[model samples]
Structure formats: C-alpha cells, structure tokens
Target: MSLPLPAPVSTYFEISNGSDIAQVTRCFTDDALVVDEGQAYRGHAAIQSWQRDAQKKFAYSVEPVGLSRNGDRLTVTASVVGSFPGSPVQLYHVFDLAGDRIRSLEIG
Candidate 1:
C-alpha cells in the first residue's frame, strides 16, 4: 500500500522518478534548501544544478514505502535502486513544507 503524501512531496517523487530536472526544481520554494550526501544546496539555482548533476551521475528509481509526520515536517521512507555502489537502499526523505511548496529537504 502507498502512504498518503502531501502535494509537494507527491509532486517531488513524480518529477524525480521522471528525471524532469526543471519541474523538480519548481517543486520547491524560491529559497528552498536540499541536503544530500551532507552537501547543502540553497535556492532554486543551486537546487537545479544539484538535480541536473545528480541525474547525470546516477540512474536511480525511488519507491516510497512509508511516511511519518511531525507538525509541518513530513518524512518519506523510500526504497531506492540505482547504479550507485549499493544496488538497493532505503532512504529517508525528510521535507519541511511552507504553504504549497517545500522549504527544505534532506535525503539520507
């Protein structure tokens, strides 16, 4: 069964799985922040570049398996498979939403 996700989170996974970098960037707020691999990307331009770079660096697919909420924060646990070292891994995608857009996202 699929967990019910917030609009921004749902749209994020949709564009991410489709490898639509441009649309993915639009899923966040203007001053959005994304942290992946301990690296921080602030603002749209940085996030856009990060997505583009990551898309080129890996061929991956994510399947959201679970979710949890804490006030305005929503955490999605997803199974990811890709060309990276680990064939399959469970990742926590923690999101902080502001209004209809995502204010920050951290992938671990």
Candidate 2:
C-alpha cells in the first residue's frame, strides 16, 4: 500500500525495509525518542543502538497499510512479517514529526 506521507515519514519505511542500520538514524532528529516493547530510547545514538539490537534479534519487514492523524501526530497501522514468534501481525507506529524529521516514534 502506498500512502501520501511526509518526506521524513516516507524515508522511515524505506530505510527500515532496507535494513541499513547506520542510515536509519538519519530519518530522525538528533534528539529523537523512540519507544518500542515498553522501552524508551532517547537521542540518535540510543535509537540507533535499539535498531541495531532489534535487527540482530529479528528479521522483519513492515508495510504501512493505513494512516491516521490527530493534531501533529501520525498513527500508522502496519503489516509486519518476520521470523519472530508472530510471523505476521498488524502493529501501530505512532510518530511525532519535527520539521523534516521524526521527533519521536512509539511502536507497539
């Protein structure tokens, strides 16, 4: 599915699917915060580390299937397929954008 997303948001999915751990940090702000699996990662370094760790632990790809907005926040419903316990599952990715970058992202 293709959605008309902001540049930073679109870059996010692209880089994520590419699995380039190094480049993933460029999609966010220097002080961006990410929350996933009940843990919060603050700043680019932490977020990068989080992504690297996750990539090492699981092989997954997410396709954004739906989008919604409330104020400046975006909620993306994505279809995830991976080698994890749940081979396929729908997940929510809530993003907060800052200028042309993502200020924060929470995935559950």
Candidate 3:
C-alpha cells in the first residue's frame, strides 16, 4: 500500500532546502507576512532580508516532524539545529496558504 504524504511537510522541506531567494519567494504570496520570535516581516523584500540575516547568524536545518491542516491553514512541528547554546530548537509553524502559495507564516 502507498503511504499518504503530508502536504505541509513537503512544502516545508521544499522551502527550507531551497537556497535561492527567487525560488523561496515563489513559495509565498506577493504580500506574504512571516512572524518569528515576536517579529513580523511583510512582503518579499522583508522576507528576503530576514532570510539573509538568519543565514548569516545561524547555520541551521529545519526538519519537519508533524503536520496538521485546517482549511487553508497548516501547522507543522519542526526540529531546528543551529549554532546557539541550545543548538536544537523545537518550533511550531502555522502557515496560511492561498492557493499554491503561503499568504502568512507564524513561528513559535
């Protein structure tokens, strides 16, 4: 039997593994909003800046462990590893999808 795959997990992997700003930008809407650690970044420009800054500060990888969806919203539990003291961080991502792109993403 074929196992069912999780959409959010697949999308998360695609976006996380993508190093190109243009390719990653394609995963989000034109006016997408991303919130992380109480900071909110709106639009592609801000998103790209945030990604660049993050890459500079932390060398990490995101591994999705669980996923759930409710209508246009998707929630994912991921394991994050970086250069910080507590190198590994467990994060929850809440994604709001509009069609094939993500309209908003909140992380905690």
Candidate 4:
C-alpha cells in the first residue's frame, strides 16, 4: 500500500527506489541537507554523492508504510529491504520540504 504523500516527497521516493542518481538529485534543493547513517550531507553535490555511495553499497527498496505531518515537516515510516546486515528493517524518514523540493531529510 502507498501513502498519499506530497508531490516532492512522492517524487523523492520514486526516484530513490529506482536509484536514479540524476533524478534523485533533482528532487532536492541546491542547499538541501540529508542526514543518514550518522553522516550529514549538505548541498546538492554532497547529497548526490551520499545517495550514490549508498546505492552502490546496497541495492535497496523502500516502501512507505506510514506518514505524519507537523507544519512543513513530514515524518515517513518505511519498510526497507536491501543487501545489508538487516535484510529488512523499518526506518523513520523526517523530511522538510521547501515548495516542490526537499529542503532536508534525516533517516534512521
């Protein structure tokens, strides 16, 4: 089942699940911030690098199972399956959107 997320959020997941580096890069703002695996990536270039590195390390799939909103921030809980220590695990992705682009995202 899919949740009705914001356009940018939905686009983010779509491109991310497909592991399209270029498209994924387009979903974020120029100064977008992403925190993942205890590392902080700032700016589009850094975020792109992070996404690429993660994709190269693990072939993964994310299914958004839950969503909650607070002002401009949206929290998404997803079930992720991939080539990692934990084959499948649930993760919380907190996203802050700026218009149709993602301003920041923290995943754990």
lDDT of 3 by residue, 16-38 (tens): 65456556566778899999879
Shift of residue 38 alpha carbon in model 2, Å: 0.5
| lDDT tens digits by residue: candidate 4, 1-108 | 969999878878886687467776567888898999899999977877887787888999999999999988999999999999978999999999988889999999
Q: After superposition, how far is residue 7 of candidate 3 from its true place, in Å?
A: 7.0
What residue runs in model 3 are displaced by over 4 Å at the alpha carbon?
1-12
Prediction 1 TM-score vs. true: 0.92
What TM-score does structure 3 among the candidates reach? 0.85
**Backbone clashes, each candidate:** 0, 0, 0, 0
- Candidate 1 displacement at residue 15 in angstroms: 2.2
Q: Which candidate wins on TM-score?
A: 4
The candidate, 1 or 2, that scores higher on TM-score is 1
- Per-prediction TM-score to the true structure, in the order listed: 0.92, 0.91, 0.85, 0.93
Which of the two, 3 or 4, has more lDDT?
Answer: 4
Selected candidate, larger TM-score, 3 vs 4: 4
lDDT of 1 at 4: 87
Q: Identify the superior model by TM-score, candidate 2 or candidate 3.
A: 2
